[model samples]
Target: MPALRLLWLGCLGSLCRAYFDGPLQPEMSNGSLHHYFVPDGDYEENDDPERCQLLFRVSEPRRCGAAPGGLSLRQELTVLGRQVEDAGRVLESIGRSSSYDLDGEESYSQYLRREAAQIGDAYASSERALSELESKFRQGREPEPRDGARPGDACLGLLLRARALLR
Candidate 1:
């Protein structure tokens, strides 16, 4: 079972990397693949108190502009992918340990539950941020694609599968 879980995780990771790093579809493309470096001064000035608070709480902030709080779609998807990976690791650990008779099973189960909840919350928050950025693009608030790559359905599917494994 553990081997099967590891195999699944490996496949999911590959799919995530391919999808997140791949080119965007025609409708999602903004025709600008150039990298935008955040200016030092602008980074400091654009750090609004509210935005900082949101960043602290959620780790993903919805920004309609090229400000310090704004993260490219690729960046956001990368973060989501990492979260999913972490969750998968936790699930894998639980599976491996389930076969052994351990004294700390109860406590370990609690810890796993907390970790899973945290991962779920972070996933939802990042998902919301992605949706908001997409909406901004649709509304013309963001003229160019922050990054030419969009994770699209692949990342979300992986996240959902990971979450299911946790359960």
Candidate 2:
């Protein structure tokens, strides 16, 4: 059973993998954490990840420009949590399918336990991220300057709120 436990725990590592692979840094709400990430198409000259040059910063509504299509740093982290949860599911299913092959039932049992823990952890992390995202949206709607901004801002904010819900 202890061996099985370890195996299960090992499987949970996949969650970590998924979390890291997804987005890490999200866009800032105020665009203070701003940098012109190359929009989906062509890579700019000398576009090094570490050397992304800053164009400018937004201090007011007009300066903010369009709602960033690129996911924000926070959003990227949330996406990672979702991916981790998905990986956990895959691992659980795999374990289920291989349950009878008791090369060592003990090891198998451990694997299952580990995978389950991973899923739970992933779920919790994702939920926390989603809650934060939801809060951000609600804050965005507080009858202020953002209220009169372009409709796109509202729509994107709503989309982000919904995406957080997906987890």
Candidate 3:
């Protein structure tokens, strides 16, 4: 049951395969704590992750661009939150599968159990950031911190990933 708890809390660490690689960073609202990120339009440069650059500081949630798609940063934030929730479901399965191991070695099932716990912690942190960012974004206010902290010009953050790209 503790494993279940861990799975519920983690942020799906490095091994957690991505179910989405699209433009996770969308433009945010004015005075937002996020930035607008888009493919540098230099796809011929190989569409490398480095190509995902900050386009501009986000505006109000209502006016933010959605980067490559029609989805605004606000909407995309919702999508990201849903994705995190979905990953938790997969982590839950992993925790359940751990029940099959009869081995006692740390490299065995117990190792997986630990991973599950770690991911749960990560997920919990991510969930908090997501929810907080979303709520503040909707209200068109500067994020407090740990999640909604304002950006470069005090208006950049993809709510989640745009911060990296914005850099």
**Candidate 3 C-alpha lDDT tens digits along 56-151:** 443344355555657876788999999999999999988766655634444566667887888999999999999999997888776445664444
Please state the error at residue 65 of candidate 3 in Å: 2.1
Candidate 1 has what TM-score? 0.23
Candidates in order, TM-scores: namely 0.23, 0.25, 0.24
Best by lDDT: 2
Q: Local distance difference test, per candidate?
A: 0.68, 0.73, 0.64
Worst ten in a row by lDDT for model 1 = 53-62
Q: What is the Cα root-mean-square deviation between model 1 and the actual structure? A: 43.1
* Model 1: residue 148 alpha-carbon error in angstroms: 99
List model 2 lDDT by residue over 1-167, tens digit each. Answer: 99999998888987766674332343675545556565555675657766554644545433343466766667868998999999999999888777756444568678778778889999999999999999999998887765569868979999999999997
lDDT order of candidates, best first? 2, 1, 3
Report the Cα lDDT for residue 16, model 1.
Answer: 85
Q: What CA RMSD would you report for each candidate?
A: 43.1, 40.9, 42.1
Q: What global local distance difference test value does model 2 have? A: 0.73
Question: Whole-model lDDT for model 3 versus the true structure?
Answer: 0.64
